[model samples]
Target chain A: MADTAKIDYKNIFYPPGGILLWIIIYLELLTFGIALVFMALNARTEPEVFHESRMLLNTAYGAINTVFLLSSGWCMAQSVHFLKTENFGKSKLFLKLTLLGGILFLALKSVEYYDKVEAGLTVGYNVFFGYYWTLTLFHVIHVIVGIVILLVLGRTLSKKPETLKVEDYESGAAFWHMCDLIWLLLFPIIYLLF
Target chain B: MERTFNATWLVLIVLTIISAVFANLDFAYAALIILGLSFLKFIGVAFFFMELKRANVFWRVLLVAFVVLLLTVVWAV
Candidate 1:
């Protein structure tokens, strides 16, 4: 009974090496919260300006991006599972799928930005446009970071299957999911709330 | 445990569609519902698909606290 209790305790509270990943995750969330507060205060001060400027955004593009990110998250989840089971081939395949999704998201986002530029909705046009472009561009930067991480992970999984690095994969996936989740909030706030 | 996508994925997909539909409605509280559902979907992805459900309670508490803090910040804004 004592041995069983010890085993249970170990399983419950003392994961061997997940602390670093958790700390990084917390810090990322903190940074996102700070940015959200900054934007919210800016919006509150100039509600009319922000609302009028928000009208220029394309909701369809925002929705499509949301779906893309969600699907990418799904694929990453599958890859994580496959990695855990040591199925290198399946893991590599799913990671490639995830990378494809990320690429597609970026391509669509670029097209959306191009459309905005052609329509003369430049960032310096107004305070709201400034915030809108800053926030969305900041998110786009994160997506780019996520894509790079996915590419690295895919490469590692394909080349060095022995060094699976499940934690790295999981952390990268978590970060990507965070990016997606934030956009899920931002999309509605920018496009639908008006 | 054998890896297989669960009902949560289906629920997330349905909620995403519902959120889009709700956005078009004339109801005053539709936005709130959409936000609420989005929060639920986020939690589902974090806990289930990310396998955080099987993680240590400390980690779970940390995540929940961070999310609550984010929600509070949003509310304050």
Candidate 2:
């Protein structure tokens, strides 16, 4: 097979769902990137506080969450591909797999948060943990939104195929991918960097 | 798309694990190296998995710009 770059998605302006979706995605990506840069800059002021708090984090847990999100993004991408091909059953199967990944991601993230709370290291503990909890908890909200969108998409696929186009499915898929994209950026920023 | 997306996933996983290893290294540029690898992973997901490869140049330019700004900030800070 040729590279994906060679496979045309038809129009640049009319990507899967609509141009507006891409706009939202672009803004979302930029917003998260800026927030991350802000965190990085803030870390520079009190490097020790950030470092000490960062060390308390379980890199393994973050790594696991990374894997889960990555897997879910993969599944969601596959689902959209199958949906475009009009392979309804395969699409749904992959959608369910994506949902499974989302569930696991939330579960692991919950455990990580619980550890912090139990240790009296909540967001109020310090600036680093503040950004940590704020960013991660916001991401959790996004994942929850993604899951709900997927459920709505699932219902659409099963009950009313005619009401939605493949591009509409792509909108939801893109949102899920956005969550994955944000996490991809967030992981190294919080877990690996000083 | 399926084959390419699968290849993209493979690259993402490999880069992630490699960066995790880089974090354990005591090298001076480990942070930069990890960030660079992660940038590659970001490209993989955006281009292949997210289908931005075939997307219009608008998305490509905007996203690449976002990466540049992110890198600049992280590098400077």
Candidate 3:
């Protein structure tokens, strides 16, 4: 008998990002997840040191950072939404707004780190500060990457307009959202969980 | 969609503000409460902003499970 296999189109789910993108996301999350777990376990050892060091860090700044990222996330979503609706101008505008958010986040984060280093609290200062700097700096690197991705998207949209696929826009947005998710885990862990 | 996004954004901001205010509280479960709220914010971002609300079962479940795993491991520690 001939093969009667049929492709199940409706059952296939390729998230906004390509499948490989999700795999990369999973790996990134796992890397951070292990770090977070180590931090938490280590925190249980010297709660006092961790809490004291954590207090040196600014909760308000972390909150502000969260707000900025969340707002930027909203902007990215809007950019994609407008793009889907075929409103190129609005999409471009929102993408710019999203990039601005990333810029502001990096700026504020740098100031926060500056205060820490100036206070003589480097990553090796203690276990908590170690994780504090390590985890947050790693996240900072991801944010930088996320911003660069957005800029590339912006460039493509501007220079080659109409050559961009919706998936291309969403691929960048999904990665940006991954950044948001990582921070959401980190904010409470490093800044608040104490 | 605009209104939905705006309202969700407002709610997320409110949650963050609430968490910040509760930062220095001297309660035993304060951390849990704050983490819970942050998780809620994550939910909003993932579902609404990331367009995961209509995602197939696997992706949605996987994301939620990941969040839960983080919460559980953190709480355990």
Candidate 4:
């Protein structure tokens, strides 16, 4: 295991997942941030529509999914930590837990989507659902990609732990946490706030 | 690192619950408080789970600035 303390964190090229992933992270956050700002502005123009549309959302599901994602994020961080400490067995276990969390979130989100569709709240339903579907569907795509990345990394780690670089593991964790962070942005503005 | 991550997760869950509770209450500032808690959650995940604490200062400050700018825009709207 490399000594994390010995590494010069001040180096622009040496974040946990490397500079390239950090760049992607920044760009991704900016994209979502701009969309959210637009949504807020749109809400300001039609507060009643936004408020009533928010009422149709199930806060319990949003809150529960937040727990699921956050817990998974914790597992991902733990997996990386164990990898750093050279505990491959525990690291693999945590990776599985993280995958489970992602799966649960996707499953629950599908149910929520189904409910909305049944209630005639599709993307073109109104401006509010327009933002809802676009922002969340974009986030869902990221989560799907994140899950695929984790699956690939988990396979490599399980079959050949020695072959998995710490950088690769950390990069996967970073992407997964990006999903968590984006959801944190979306949940409050969409489900809680009008 | 384990303790820190665990503690951070606990705080995030608690904050989520608090946000949910506040969502139930109708008040002018409930939205503000909930958004504030959400931003706090964002910071916790970025710093602890994403390991920004070990990153360069530029990355850390960039994230903080992003959150502040986002919060300001959302609040202004």
Tell me the interface RMSD of every candidate, in Å. 3.5, 1.5, 1.9, 0.9
Query: Per-residue lDDT of A10-50 in model 1, one digit per residue for the tens?
Result: 35444322556556656766776677667667888887877
Which TM-score value belongs to model 4? 0.97
Candidate 1 runs further than 4 Å off:
A1-17, B1-6, B72-77
Best by lDDT: 4
What are the root-mean-square deviations of the candidates from the true structure over C-alphas?
A: 4.6, 3.7, 4.9, 1.6
Better of 1 and 3 by DockQ: 3
For candidate 4, what is the recovered fraction of reference interface contacts?
0.88
lDDT of 2 by residue, B1-77 (tens): 78888888888888888888887678899888988987888888777777887777877888888886797688788
Best-fitting candidate, scored by DockQ: 4
Alpha-carbon runs more than 4 Å astray in model 4: A1-6
How many Å off is the CA of A57 in candidate 3? 0.6
* TM-scores of the candidates in the order shown: 0.85, 0.94, 0.94, 0.97
Judged by TM-score relative to the true structure, which candidate is superior, 3 or 4? 4
Task: Show the lowest summed lDDT stretch of 10 residues, model 4 chain B.
Answer: B68-77
Docking class of 2: medium
Looking at model 1, residue A24 earns an lDDT score of 62
Docking class of 3: medium
Candidate 2's residue-wise lDDT over A1-194, tens digit each?
01113234656766654578778888888878888888998999999998888889998898888889998999999998887676878988999999999999999999988989999999899989999999999889999999999999999887765565766787888888888888988889898887
lDDT of 1 at A21: 55
lDDT against true structure, model 4: 0.92
Better of 1 and 2 by TM-score: 2
